[model samples]
Target: MSLQVRIMTPDRIFLNEEAEEIILPTNTGQMGVLKNHAPLITALDIGVMLIRSKNEWTPLALMGGFALVKQNQVTVLVNEAESAETIDPNEVENSFTIAKTKLEQAEGQKQKVEANFVFKRERARYQVIKQAKKM
Candidate 1:
């Protein structure tokens, strides 16, 4: 048996299919879900979500939201999502470098917070592409 996975954003449904395994980037940490997993809800973080189907892994950049796992069904609703296939690796790499520099140079608390968020987002996107290439 496989888990029904549906990932959605405000603009559209990003994915709707079956997955053998799912690795979610939750606020607490990474959570793995499989068939017959217990029902629960979790707040996601800006990170990479890895979905495995048919022995192949696909990575996606999730921009924070919520996820529900119930009866072998996983529903992910995120503020934004970017697929590895759609992202430009070169652009993401450059943005990630810039974000890291900005975060390091940030002065005030507010600047640090904003810069940190951008750094995380760009890092997530970069990781997704890297993971996809490996798999």
Candidate 2:
């Protein structure tokens, strides 16, 4: 059996994937979902969600949001989402570096915001890059 996943953002719908299993990036940590798992609605961490289909795994980066799971269907509504094909290693690395620098020099609320964004983006980079290597 499989499940339904719809990943959306303010700009557009990033994905509507169907798979045998899903690995979510929860704020607490990673959580795995399979058919008939308990119903849940939980926060999504800034990381990656791996989709398993036909014995193949597809990985995509995700930002904070919420996921609603009931029965065997999971709707992933995220703040931001990106596929491996869409991520640029150089760009992600630069963003991570800039965020780190801002954190070090952070002195105000604005700096804190920048630092948070950096952390979120860097987490995506790490997840996607690791998936790329495995594939």
Candidate 3:
């Protein structure tokens, strides 16, 4: 098994433990890190990190982050990570609608920022929805 694994966000560190493997949503795509994985670090996209341990796949919603795998330890410093099961479908859907409308009306830098925020939130929400379908 891998020695240690951590998934951290600015607000909290959701998980930390020894795991058999971790599947991350890299900027490029999804990839798995096993024990003694080749030393490498990469950026994470807004997607799911499927942590494999305890004979189960734990879905971690990562908005963005960087991952480091070394010496059988994997650490993911993410901007966000939320359990898909805990998310309320209505919340995600409502947020998406608000974000889409703001994005559609964006006209200036400040407006654009709002739009971007919405986009990110909606994307994360959609990811949760998609991952929920898998479970």
Candidate 4:
């Protein structure tokens, strides 16, 4: 049986459909979900979410957020989300470079922390786009 999966951001619903499986990027690490998986609520991280259906995988870039699983239903709510087709590799690479420079030039602890966060997010985006291009 397939699981009902729904993914949303503040502005829109990213996805809503039946999925054979889903791999979430959780704060702890990657978590795979299948039909009738145990119920849970977990914090997400800046990474790629892989959704599989009929042996085909779809990748989505996600910012920090949360996910809930209950009764074979999976719901992901994120600050931002983008499908593989919508990502621009050039933009991602440019952002990564900018964040990297900012992180290197950051002065104080607060600036460093903020720069690091942006760096991580841009790195995640770059990774996701790279993976998607290979598919």
Predictions in order: lDDT: 0.96, 0.84, 0.79, 0.90
**Candidate 2, superposed: residue stretches over 4 Å from native:** 108-110
Query: Candidate 3, after superposition: displacement of residue 60 in Å?
Result: 1.5
lDDT, candidate 3, equals 0.79
Q: Compose the digit string of candidate 1's lDDT tens values, residues 83-132.
A: 98889988999999999999999999999999999999999999998998
TM-score of 3: 0.76
lDDT of 3 at 50: 77
Per-residue C-alpha lDDT of model 2 across residues 5-99, encoded as one tens digit per residue: 78889899888868899999898999999989899999988888898988989888887899999978898888788887888877877777777
Predicted candidate 4 versus true structure: per-residue lDDT over 1-135, tens digit per residue: 789999999999989999999999998999999998999999999988998988888888889899999999999999998876777878889999999999999999999999998997888788788878777
All candidates: TM-score: 0.98, 0.86, 0.76, 0.92
TM-score between candidate 2 and the true structure: 0.86
lDDT of 3 at 117: 66
Consecutive 10-residue window with the lowest summed lDDT within model 1: 126-135
Prediction 2 global C-alpha lDDT = 0.84
The local distance difference test score of model 1 is 0.96
Best by lDDT: 1
Residue-level error in angstroms, candidate 4, position 29: 1.0
Compose the digit string of candidate 3's lDDT tens values, residues 1-135.
455998888988778888787788787888988887888989988776777777777676788889988888888898877887778877888877888888988998998986886687577766767766776
| Runs in model 4 lying further than 4 Å from the true structure | none
The model with the greatest TM-score is 1
